[model samples]
Target: MHSRSERELGSGFPAVTTPLHALTLRAAANSIRAGELSSEAYTRALLERIAATDANVQAWAYLDPEGALAAAREADAERRAGAPVGPLAGIGIGVKDIVATLDQPTQLGSPIYTGARPAYDANCIERLRQAGGFVLGKTVTTEFAFIHPGKTRNPWRAGHTPGGSSSGSAAAVALGQVPAAIGTQTNGSLIRPAAYCGVVAFKPTLDALPFQGVNVFSPTLDTLGVLARSVADCALLASCLADPGGIPGDVEPIGRAPRLALLAAFPWVATSIEQEWAMHAALATLRDSGAVVTPVELAEAWHDAQRVHRMIMLYEGAQQMRDLQAREREQLSAKLNAALDEGREFGDGAYHAALARRDILIAAITEWLAPFDAIVAPPASASAPADLTHTGDPSCCTLWSLLGFPAVSIPIAVADNGLPLGLQLAATAGADERLLAVAQWCEERLAFKGLL
Candidate 1:
């Protein structure tokens, strides 16, 4: 953590002597707009913090302090000159390497595009800038947003995987290196990392945000998501990206406790003893808060959801990366190549069947969600595992990704081993705003403050 330099406290906005990088996205923006803090100073503080701590976390893939500082200076100048300011003005955000950025190189966590820099900003990045947020750097990601792990390590526990794809984004936010960051989820890329790294991860309803410049990995399930320290920060990013005009000025109350359904276990698997205890504790907290918690499960019709999800992901992923496999087979990881091979072998008929089966399950889950504000489940079977080679299993996240529903993972507790545990809350597709509202309510009630 970096300390703020001695400076005169401005008139209205009080000067912040504490570390500036620890503030949430909304708070930083508010402070910057009030002239209490300079965006350049804020960004510089974060850059210094990154310099200090990133060596241990290894979360960043590409960083350009000069470019980031320049952008922050412009924001400060614009604010001082009485120019129109967006809600996210001066807020710092980290961009996942898989997402295209005009400034940072998008390496896709592989040497295939080691120095590839896109000419146009990804739609998400474009809107983030328009909202006055500046990209602090590009965070590391899994190879092609798949199971391949990156160099990023869990900030809470060293030598453990921070989970995939969104590894850097989640680690950066959890360690207070950045207030918020953009992450993409195809198969738990966003939620898994958030769960393992102990941060808030939000994957809105499919297509609710932008993915125009993101690398395609199962278009049916691909989603642009975010990670931050708090639910309000996630909501702020979601609101700004969905409709900059509709961004809430602050974290507003949802007015009532959400009627949530507690799913104790996946239909195909069971939770570990520690996971069970953590989950039950979360449910108990909600019940004590006067919220209705119901137990539910998907019947035989959904028994194959996880299997079918993999079918579709593999089929679509293989088709998407066909050209790359044909030309650069050596560059691809064995794991990824094996997946692609399986996908190619999966018949077109099977792929279509899987898609149809997925649609049926979506309808079933939608009906299940109709009677509740949201559904609560475990984000993973355990906390960040001790191994760095494997980025944990994706079974817990497979069904949600297949459904393309809005999902939020909030860190609710810690395991006996000291790794962080996340509670997964999801709503029916297109219920993103309500989901965020309910999620914020649950987040406050759980009161499981992070250690980092």
Candidate 2:
């Protein structure tokens, strides 16, 4: 594998350079736009880095070096012409394989459709490109963004699962293979993997980024998000892909300590000792910094979190992929087929009841969160588990995903085993702007450090 020192970045228009792979998406774009970095050179540097490291990491589903360079070179030409550039101009982002792209196959990480290629770009892809970015490639995802884990290995430690189903997106960003990548979460898919991979992941409120052209696992629960190195970098991407005109600007200028609730309250879910330590350490840091942190209760009202999330996921997922099963039953994973069978057996009345309870829970949670700016918790039950066949437990993420609320995973500490431990902060539904601000404040206080 090539060391970081061997890879270098060059200047834009003329000739400039840095360790392009290490920079955040927003920072790289600024460098490129200012003629201090060439988009093509930067893109090439990453592709080379990925080529050197991807054999072990396996973070990509579809990579087109030629296509990426062509777009980057075109961007350089546009910049040289003194043309106006978008905020993301010259930056490259990895689209989760589930998100369709015009040029790459949208492999859902299932053997049933190994080479499925959609003819059109997902709605967000078009918006992303229009805002001055190009698709670097498709990152790996768990089959159908469901329970099945993908082949992506945790970049920080080998033989450990990177949390899924947004496995590759988080691993790519953490490995410095790409500045940022998009991922989807039905439950903990985005946040858990990012926490495990030691990167920043932001799952904005439901429908913040349209789901059109992307495969649906559970329409109500699934939401697209970005995994990057830092909160501000995530903000840069969120400003473009999040609900148009809804994203907040400059989360840095917050005036006071954010009112946050420490939600260590899931009776149904238990945290490992390592997880508890990480949470306490993070809470101490935040408390020391003048933020008001208080323990909050959640299980009393939503005691059936995991069960309800699974029910909805199975119900919707089964219908969404019914055709795939009908045509390619033999090709599907045994675990997936079993889940599909369970989904097929879920009663329609139970599904409706789950939806009803979802609404009720959202209302209750909204009221409870009226005072605090955001709720804080551990990203998962523990850091990435040693097992690769099973993605780590996602119980911590189920509540927020169930409510369609915005959640961000910020790496705050390290585990005894040398893996990352993260803090999960969630905001009320549609309160994403404030949520970003709160996350920024917490990020600043925590000052997360990664392997890169």
Candidate 3:
């Protein structure tokens, strides 16, 4: 028998028919502001879409349709009253379950806090509210945002994995359940999932967005990010969350073509042939579009990035989960416990040494990469795996996460299996705005038409 997704997506995975739910974040906000569409109408369409698709997708941890509609009505009322509406005035955003939401539960994808509700909104959520966006629901996350996979499945094809730990956020956006969603990355949580799901993921420099109300696994490496259908959408959502003044429209143009440094394959990782072909195709397209594409090799000092990143992540993660481990050992997964065990074996001296080495390499690589606008590589080793037992390997993302660089993943091609492929563009730390601009420029040249 044919599967459900094969039926829903169709044999060709045809261009998504233009429905109200298929509107982009920018288009939705503009329509609501222009009185051409009501927030309630837009929200109802999304709710119906979620209801129709989420049975197989399972992208949400918690959803309250009634509450979401109520908030949508409030936004419409404000616009009717002639009050100034924010840039994201009527947008519905899906928050990762780990982020605190006063109105919904932040379950952390663990049984230990099954029904736990936060008393206040996370800093990012509060900012999103100020920008006139409402939280549609909480998306599922892996246990403590660690290695364990969640219930989310790839939207392109059924029975395939969506890379974690930001599994649900990426899938929900790709499925048109929400225009944009909040996610975080310590290693590859944001980029890998976005790549696997055929969406845009932007992980800004470390601490670009605050982590105050988000559950912490590795305090040093944890960074808040956003997932959306397009590069401009990611820029909008991320800028809204990071800005203290709550500017929701911060997407800027790159006045000229960008210079990109291409690494055909990531170091010491097994990349699929499909992924390599996609990268080459993307580079050729960019070159034809008058952009500079130069091939570059990794510096010798950057050889141990994955190992060092693991050391720091596990050590800090172990400390962060210490109390929970002591109190509810049985409630945690064997995979998490195993990681924690490895982390505990890392003494303070070893952890500090890793940190010291990271500092030196950061400076070395940053200078080496200073000449280029971005370092381009494949975001993940391959398309989403055939089954959902585990998320894909994250070795390609380790170096950028370790150095606290700003990165964006742009969907470029679809694999032979009909799964999407993406290329990662990373820039120096503190160059977030410039990185977004370059990504936008590259995105225009690539002209990726994503599956809805």
Candidate 4:
């Protein structure tokens, strides 16, 4: 079992050579824009690093070294041609296997579709390409992006599991294998892994980014998210993925002291003792720093969020993969197969009722969020668990996903055992920009105080 300790807290892996790797992303882009560094140089460095470190990490499901270099060369040529470069020009991004790419295999992390490759790139991948981001390769994902564990181990502690189904993407980012990667969440895929790996993860409102061509787990709860080292980095990437006119500029830092709502009881769930303390420590830090941290009651309906999320997920999972089950029943994971079976037991009326309840919950939570700039809580029940047999609980993420709210996980403290702990912040629906702005403020404050 992984335990958090002061020494383990905030100890991230070394930086990678790829422009998409956080440390290199800005510097590489700055150099290339100034004609001081060629895209080839950056790409080469990244490819070499991946070759050196990825074998044991198993963060990648597919890697196309030649294709990556070719793309980088093209980017360099475009720069020499004096063409306008996109915001992410020459950046190398790792894609979650569930997010299809035309140039790389899309395995969806399932033995059932062991050799499956989609003909077209997923919508997010298409957008990234259009933005001048080169696909480094497809990162590993849990089977069908479900609970079945992937091979990724947390960079902070090798024997521990990197949270899934976005395991590879989070691990890749945490290890400096990639600057940023695209991940999807049905339950805790994005936030949990990001927390476990001690990196920044942002799950924007559901449908905030295009989802076409991506493998679906739960249509109602599924969300596209980004994993990065910093909130600013996430904001920058998010801007690129969003529609040109729709994307806002750098959020002007909020001038007034930020008002934050702390979910006192967190609905029906009870937090672990360690998690409770971590939150208390975080809240204490924020309060001492002048941020208004007020206690607020979440909507009563949020108590059923987990069940509602599961009902939607199981129903959608069964519907989406019914054909696959017919042809490859034996290939599905036992856990997923059981889920499908359970889903089949629910009548359409019951499923529809759950959907209705979800909508009501979203509305109530949205209303509850009116007064606070953001809501803060523990990212998970505890630090990454010792057992890799099961991915940590998604309960921490259930409320936010159900409400279609934008949520960000920030590494706040480490436990006594050398594992990292994360603090979660969620904003109202459609207030993604504002949420990010508040996060930036919190991040700056934390950094200034040496609390990160």
**Per-model TM values vs. the true structure:** 0.96, 0.95, 0.95, 0.91
How much is the lDDT of residue 100 in candidate 3?
99
Question: Ten-residue segment with the worst summed lDDT in candidate 1?
Answer: 1-10
Model 2: per-residue Cα lDDT over 1-452, one tens digit each = 33333333342233223466877787788877777677887898899889878898899988889999999999999989988898888888998988988878998888766888889999989889888898999998988887778888999887899989999999999988999888898989999998999999999999888889888878879898888998888888877886668775346556788889998746767888988888888789888989998888775657876688889989998998888888998888888899998999999999999888888888988998999989998888888988988888888899899999999999988887999988899989888878888888888888667977
lDDT value, candidate 1, whole model: 0.86
Candidate 1 per-residue lDDT, tens place, 1-452, comes to 22463222456544445567677788778777877778887888788888878888899999999999999998888888888889898676899998888988999999989999899898888888888887889999999999988899999887899998899999999988898899999888888899998899999888888889999989999999888899998888877777553434355677988899988788766678888898899889889998899998767767899889899999999999999999999999999999999999999999999999888899988987899989988898888888989898877887889999989999988888888898999999988777888889988888776744
Full candidate order by TM-score, most accurate first: 1, 2, 3, 4
Q: What are the per-residue Cα lDDT tens digits for candidate 3 across 1-452? A: 42221212324434334687888898888878877677887888889889988898899999999999999999999999998888798888999999999999999999989999999999999989998898999999998898898888998887898899999999999999999999999999999999999999999999989899999999889999999999888988887898663323566787888998988776779899999999888889889988898899786657788889999999999998888898998999999999998999999999999999999988998998999888898899899899788888988888899999989998999999999999999999988878888888888888666766
Please give the distance, in angstroms, between residue 250's alpha carbon in candidate 2 and its true position after superposition.
Answer: 3.4
The reply for model 3, stretches above 4 Å from the true place, is 1-17, 245-248
- Looking at model 3, report the run of 10 residues with the lowest lDDT sum: 1-10
How many backbone clashes can be found in candidate 4? Answer: 11
**Each model's backbone clash number:** 0, 6, 0, 11
Candidate 1 off by > 4 Å: 5-17, 243-251
lDDT of 4 by residue, 388-429 (tens): 777788788888887788999988777776777788899988
Better structure of 1 and 4 per TM-score: 1
Error of 3 at 395 (Å): 1.1
Relative to the true structure, candidate 1 reaches a TM of 0.96
Better candidate number, 3 or 4, judged by TM-score:
3
lDDT (C-alpha) at residue 147 in model 4: 91
lDDT of each: 0.86, 0.85, 0.88, 0.79
Q: RMSD to the native, candidate 3? A: 5.1
